[model samples]
Target chain A: EAGVTQFPSHSVIEKGQTVTLRCDPISGHDNLYWYRRVMGKEIKFLLHFVKESKQDESGMPNNRFLAERTGGTYSTLKVQPAELEDSGVYFCASSPYRTGPTGETQYFGPGTRLLVL
Target chain B: AQTVTQSQPEMSVQEAETVTLSCTYDTSESDYYLFWYKQPPSRQMILVIRQEAYKQQNATENRFSVNFQKAAKSFSLKISDSQLGDAAMYFCAYRSASGGSEKLVFGKGTKLTVNP
Candidate 1:
């Protein structure tokens, strides 16, 4: 019954460095999503995973960002050569499989705060 | 494209009092969902309440409730018996059923301060 959890609650790295943020979805959850809130900006969706397959990644900002979910249990978002603008709080959410037309409520994790110096 | 608007950037309410946070959204589709999420200083996004467009009755969760107006494309949250714990950044969100991808469009949040 645990909620989604994230790793490295806070991270600091120099510009052009690499940082990896991890997330562990709740047990039995089939859908996982990644979102972020940059400086003074609203939270925005990054990508989604259904099981081991990436259901959608249209929200991904650019090529420098990479996300992966192995074994459908956990997820990782990696930023290479991070930019100053990449500094923000990254959130991970998970939900059970949707069986009906009703929208499923997603439970969020404590976000990972990344600072690109 | 769908967008959510929260006109009030900040609001405050006395403890045990009631406060309403307004939100307006624009969308072409009729079937959609609206949500109110609270992010306290801890920065965890918590679901407050949600409203389905096809349902006429509003959604209520304990002290949290929503006033959903389909015609106005407006969804406002009313928190009754506001407590110090209620002080947080509340975001109004919109999700479309026809978008194929389950993505939430969020508005710039409104910070709520509950006075004890």
Candidate 2:
């Protein structure tokens, strides 16, 4: 099975520009998540989606950031009027929806490196 | 809220030697999961090993193993016979086993270098 894949492995844009990152999860996986890692910092969770509905979005940093999963398949994270602090590596992960002693293991994609100048 | 910490910013080891990466986490939940992920330069992050809090026994995968101390709230990764390919940024992460929250909490990460 193919792993999670992301589009535009690297993006460079000016501050105040809008950028959209896309992620295609593994086939048949219902759980999708987005995380970001700033330079020299830990990876922080942004949001999660189960199918077409959002499961949790408390981690979202601000109103400028928005994420959507359409048709319960792929996800997109949009940063409008992106600021310099928004530059970082954005990672998307997915896992099968299963409940058991062994919790769901997330598979990550090659993160998209965004640089806002 | 739970937090994960990796004290070591960077570490080095000679090829064929063993190295351990330290991690400490703070969590009140009894049932949870811990993970170690390896991210090589310009590559996707991959899982190295994971340990369920309920399991006393540590988790091992080939040359990679974890020293999980539940009481001490510690989870460390030990790489035996370290290869040059093992050089990467190692991250320690924690996840709650609850039904609603499935997001992972990650540490700042430790960069490992294997000298040949």
Candidate 3:
């Protein structure tokens, strides 16, 4: 089976530009998550999508960041007026609802490297 | 709140030798899961091995295994007969086994180098 996939393996944009990162998860996966690692920082969770609903977004940093999963399919993360600090590796992961919530093994994608100048 | 820490930023192991990466986490939840993920040059996060908090026996996947200390909140990964392919960034992660909190908390990561 094909694993999770992401778009635009690398992105370069200005500090005030808008950028959108996309993630296509494995088929039949209900739980999708987004995480990012800023320069010199550990990878941190951003948000989670269970089907078409936002299960958890407490990790979202601010309103400038937005995430959406329509029709319970792929997901997208959009950063508006991106700042220099937004330059980092954004990783997307997905897992089935089986194995309970926390027990499920997450499969990650080849992260999208965003560079803001 | 849960936090994971990796004390060693870098480690090296000779081929056919063994290497251990240390990790510690702080969490109030008793039942949870600890995992070790390997990120190679491709930058894809790959699950290496996992240990359930309730399991007393360590979890092993071929040459990779984990030493999980529940009381001490320590989880270390041991790679035996290390190969060149084992040289990568190893990350320790924690996940609460509860119903609502399912996100993984990851450490700063440890870079492992294999010397031939």
Candidate 4:
């Protein structure tokens, strides 16, 4: 099976610019998640999507960041007027549905390295 | 809120030797999941191993294994017969067992260097 794939392995943009990162989860996976790690910090969760519905988005840093899953097959994260602190690596992961038995294991992608100058 | 902690910032172990990396977490939930991820220099996060909160047995995968302590809220990883390819940033993670919250909470990470 093909693992999760992310577009634009590396992105470099200046402050006040806009950039969108995309992620394609494994086929048939119902759970998709977004996470990122800033300099000197651990990887933090951003949001999660179950099928076409967003299950959780409490981890989003601010309103400037937006995420959408049009058809539930893939997802996009957009940042408007990006700030210098927005530079970091954004990761996308997905897992099969949990059936209340054993917890599911999430598969991660290579991640996109975003640098806002 | 659940939080994972990795006390070691970095560690080095000679090839063919065994090394243990420490991790601790704080959570009020009785059931959850713990994971160890290895991010190589290529920057890809790979799942090394995982342990369920209710499982009494430690998890093992090939040369990688975990020491899970429920009472202490501690989960550690041990690499046996370490290889040069094992050098990378190892992160400890936690996930809530209830609800649809599948997001993982990660620790600061420990950079493991394998010396040949």
Query: Model 3, stretches more than 4 Å misplaced?
Result: none
Q: Is candidate 1 or candidate 3 better by lDDT?
A: 3
Across B46-73, the per-residue lDDT of candidate 3 in tens digits comes to 9999988999999999999888989999
Q: Which has the higher TM-score value, candidate number 1 or candidate number 2?
A: 2
Give lDDT tens digits, candidate 2, residues B11-99.
99999999999999999899999999999998999998999999999999999999999999999999999999999999999999875
List, residue by residue over B1-116, the lDDT tens digit for candidate 4.
Answer: 88899999999999999999999999999999999999999867899999999999999999999999999999999999999999999999998888657789999999999998
Model 3 reproduced share of reference interface contacts: 0.76
Q: Pick the candidate with the highest lDDT.
A: 2
Q: Write the per-residue lDDT of candidate 3 for residues A9-87, one digit (tens) a residue.
A: 9999999999999999999999999999987778999998999899899899999999999999999999998999999
lDDT of 2 by residue, A1-117 (tens): 899999989999999999999999999999999999999899999999989899899999999999999899999999998999999999999999876535778999999999999
The per-prediction tally of clashing pairs is 0, 0, 0, 0
- The CAPRI class of candidate 4 is medium
Count of backbone collisions within predicted model 2 = 0
In Å, candidate 4's interface RMSD is 1.7
Index of the highest-DockQ prediction: 3
lDDT per prediction?
A: 0.91, 0.95, 0.93, 0.93
**lDDT per residue, candidate 4, A1-117, as tens digits?**
899999989999999999999999999998899999998799999999988899899999999999999888999999998999999999999999766635688899999999999
* Candidate 3 local lDDT, residue A37: 90
Per residue, candidate 1 scores C-alpha lDDT tens digits across B1-40 of: 8899999999999999999999999998999889999999
Estimate, for each residue in A47-82, the C-alpha lDDT of model 1 and write its tens digit: 989998998899899999999998999999999989
